[model samples]
Every structure is written in structure tokens, then in C-alpha cells.
Target: MAGPVHPARGVSYPVTALFMVGVFLLGAAFIASYVGGLHAPHPHRVPVAVAGPADATARVDAALRREGDAFDLRTYPTTASARQAIQHRDVYGAYLPQQGRLLITSAFGPTTSGLLRSAFAPVAAADGLRLSVQDVVPADPGDPEGLVPFYLVIGWIVSAYLVAAIVGLYRGMAAITLRDALVRLAAFAVYSAVAGAMGTLIVETGYGYLPDSPWPLTGVGALCVFAVAAATAAAESLLGIIGTALTILVFVVLGNPSAGGPWPLPLLPAFWRTAGPWLPNWAGTEAVRNAVYFDGHALTRPLLVLAAYAAAGIVLFLLLAGRTNPVMRFPAHSTA
Candidate 1:
């Protein structure tokens, strides 16, 4: 017999191989998800508020309808009412036909404002009037694109999941016992709080990007961070290292595209639009924006979603505590 058969390179470096393949697949999925979500931005039935003379409102509404029902118009009795709707995020833009002004919320979405300008400018010109666009809830001067909030929340989520993954890889995917799991949760809570505060500090105190109340952002940040971390930790407890990959798939590959960040909800494909509001990225971004710009007008949904994830994750992690990591066990490389 041959003296002693040895494992091939593939078997010897199994961890490296697994990670390489996992990364490759993840990269592909990343491309597919983003491309599929944003490649075609056919906005249809976008809600808009129209006020002023019936004739002008009808004219714009007719034009919008002729363009494949691009806008679903709601006739408000007064410009004040239309402005209120925009603050509530009920409408993307309001066209005051009599005043020949378009009220938009860049905070709602920069692209959305641009779209409104494009649509209303020509209509106003047709009537021999110059359309003046005003951003009622304008994006922060520092963050003219209104992308910082989304990016900030994305940073929190990424760190949250990475923390869970790293902790699992080093100590074991699952907790060593009930106490261990409890401790882990508590530690993450503190970490989440710190992360949230630090983000606020950087955004508000450092750059004054979002010159609104800091407490709300802090609360949302902490909740979002804890939720993602707990969710990832719960998955790791049961699935070992593969759980991290699954976490990335859910949070990054799918979550980012469906986040309503890189693109507005109306501009996104149907799948992403339907899927956006359910993910942490979407909830977090919305909540942050609500705090910074909308004065927390619609924060209940995002908060509820984050709380559900955090609660369920903590419960599951506790129940499923104490398990071995199948992949990260690290067998001895030395041969006898």
C-alpha cells in the first residue's frame, strides 16, 4: 500500500475553500439583486397632491394619466392641505396650479423631487407660467442628496452582524450555556447603545448633517443595531458559520437593494418595492429620516419591526443556547 495517503489541497484548506466559494456566490447574488431591483425605474401610480383651479389641476392630472397613469392625483381643497400631506409622506409632490409652484420634499427623495420638476415644469409652461419648485422638507444642506441617514443605518447594520459573526467564530457559534447567552445579549445591548450614540455624535455634533433631535435617531439606531445583531446571533446558534453567510444574504444582498436607499420606492422594481419596507435597512432608514426631517410622523412601523426582530432573536438564542460550530472547530494540521 502507498505509505500513507494524504488529503488533497481542497480538503486540507476546507475553511478557505468554503469561504471562497461562499464569497463568490454572495458576490453574484449581490450583483443580481441590485441590478434586478434598480435596472428599470418605471414609476407608476406615484401619489401626488394637486391643488388650485380645477381646470389647471385637471390639465396636469390628465397629462399624468396620459403618461400611463404615472401619477395618482388627490385633489386637496387648499395648498395648505397638500403641504400637510407632503409632510405626512402621503404624497411625493404637490402642484399648485394657480400659484404655478410645485412643492416637493427632497427629504422624501431627491430623485422624486426631480421627477416632479420635470413633470410640472412643462405643464406650467404650457399655460404661459413659470413653475417654481420649492422643497418643503428639503434635504439637509450638508446631505443634499438625503443619503447620509441611509448610509448611517447601513453602517450600524453591517457592524451589528459582523459583531455577531466574529464573536461566534471565535468563541463558538452558540453560547456555552444559558447564562452565556444572556450575557451575550446584555453585552450587545450596551454595544448597541454606544453605537447609536456614536452615530448621532458623528452626524449631529461632528458635521451637523441632520440638525434635528438626536434622541430619536439614537433610539432608532440602538434598536436597529440590536435587532440585526440578535437576529444574526440567533441564526449562528443553530447553523454555525453558514449562518453568517445567510445573514449577509438577507441583510446585504437582498436588504440593501430592497432598502429604498439607493433608489426611491416608486423608482424601484415591483419586487424590491414590495420587499423594501420589511427589512431592517428600510425600517432604519425610514425611521432615521422620520426623526431628522419628518419629526417622527411615521415611526411606529419601523420601531415595531425592529422590536419584533430583537425580541424574537433574543428568545430564540436563549432557547437554542449551547451548540458546537461545525465549520469553525479547527482540526489540527500536524500529521502524526
Candidate 2:
């Protein structure tokens, strides 16, 4: 007969609390980066499109200048041309001569759009121009406020290292065998597929948890999941528990805020802004955006980076696993 086991009999409360504290610290780091990046002020040097005759263009440019140093105004022949500029991200906003309609972009961040709005005010006031705003490339309805992509990528990042930590806790510090490596790789593949599907569902459905995707959204999600998982697994293979924390700090804390998600890269401080592209989160976010809005044109470089990480991780795992390093053994106590 088996004795009844209390719920907490085998668990150490202190260890659990300590581990929770560490996780909390990681969460705090993420919050600090997200909120800190948001609170830190930035001035926008957004490009603007002014469409009209040369005289009208010059007139609008001068009026915009009076509004302050906000816009880098350029002249365009027509509103269509200006729209193209905004789509290409060459300009943040556009103005049409007919009825003085204002074409604002969500392609850029709110701060950049706000700068354009400010610059247009003086121009409108000077010329008695009536203003109308339009979003040429609107954010997905499912992703209202344009935060779904960021959150989705963040979730994948969390899951990746969460799995690594769980595995590490059970397995301890041991080099992976080739079979073990293959199993983990297979697990990553499955997880990525599920993550991709869930991401797509959240974006497409009115779940209110994620944004909308146009096309190839699932593929983007899969790649993002794979990148995060591969990197986390590699880190754990290399540095054990410490590497898990570093993964969170690097991807969630520093990388998320620096990514051109809530704020465009130009709006972040130079240090975080510069660091964004090199990290996994940035690669995923950029790829998501490319799939959703940019017709997948801008995803090549970031995808390449992720693929490199995956390949390097596999190779390193194989090499490490093949070695038979000596194990320390302790003698059993003798009962006299």
C-alpha cells in the first residue's frame, strides 16, 4: 500500500520562490524595455509629400517650415505619386492640391504620424487649406492600434525559452546526444507549426487578442517560432540555465522595444534602435510586417539571419553531443 503524499511534500517552497523571483526579474526587464522605450522622448524627422505645381509646392513647404522643424518636405506631381512614396516608406505623410486632402500613414509609428500632423497644421492655417486624413496602408483590423505582431512574436519568444528551461530542469547540465538533438529539433518543428496556425487564427479571427494578416501570415509565424526555438535550444545547450535568462533578456527586453513595432526604429534611442536588427525579435517582426503589408519584399535578409541561427545551432549541438566527456561520481556512504 502507498502512503498519501501531501501536495507540497516533495517541493521546496524557497526554491520555487527564488525561481519565481528570477522570472519576475525577467518580466520586469521586459516591461522596463517596453515602457521605457515608449516613455523616452524622440523628435521625428519624417519625410512628407507635397503635391502640386512648383509654386504651390514651394508655398506649402515654406508654410510647413513655419510649423517648426518637423518635416522633410518633398514635391510630387500628383497625389498618386505621393501615395507611392508613403507605401515605399520614403515619406510619412502626403498632401494633395485638390481640396488639400491630407494622406497620413500608419506605415510609420504614431510619433512620426503626429509630427506630420503638427507640420501640416501651420501649412493649413497659412493657406486656409481644409484637411482630410486617409490611411493608404491601414493597419489590420484584427490588429487594431497595430500591436498584434509585436505581441505575437513576444509570445513565441517566451514559449521557446520556457520549453528550454523546463527541459533543463529535468535533464540538468548534460551534453545532448545526436538522438536527443534530433528529438528536440523535431519538437521545435511541431511547435513552430502549431504556433504559426495559432498566430494566423488570432490575426484573422475577431479574437481581439491579435491583429489581422493578409497572406503568408502563417508561414511568417512558423519561421518566427523556429528562429526563437532554435536560438533558445542552442543557448541552453551552450550555457545551461544562465543562457535561458539571457535569451529572454536579449529577445524580449532589448529586442522587442528596439524593433520597429510600437515605434519606428527612428523614434527609439540610438542605442536600442541600432541593436534591434541584430536580434531575433526584430527579424521576426520585420518578416511579419513584410508578409502582412509589404508584399513580402523586405523579409529576405532577416530570414537569412534566422536560418543561419538555426543551422549553427544544429551543427553545434551535433558536435557537442558526439563527445563523451568524463562524469564525476561520488562514492556511496557505508553503514558500519
Best by lDDT: 1
Worst 10 residues of 2 by lDDT: 325-334
- Which portions of model 1 show Cα errors greater than 4 Å? 1-18, 53-55, 325-329, 332-336
lDDT of each: 0.86, 0.69
lDDT of 1 at 260: 74
In model 1, the worst 10-residue window by lDDT is 1-10
Per-residue error (Å), model 1, residue 311:
1.7
Report the C-alpha displacement of residue 233, candidate 1, in angstroms: 0.3
- Candidate 2 local lDDT, 121-157, one digit each (tens): 6666667776667777776654546666777777776
RMSD of 1: 3.9
TM for candidate 2 is: 0.77
Candidate 2, backbone clash total: 2
- C-alpha positional error of residue 249 in candidate 2 after TM-score superposition, expressed in Å: 0.9
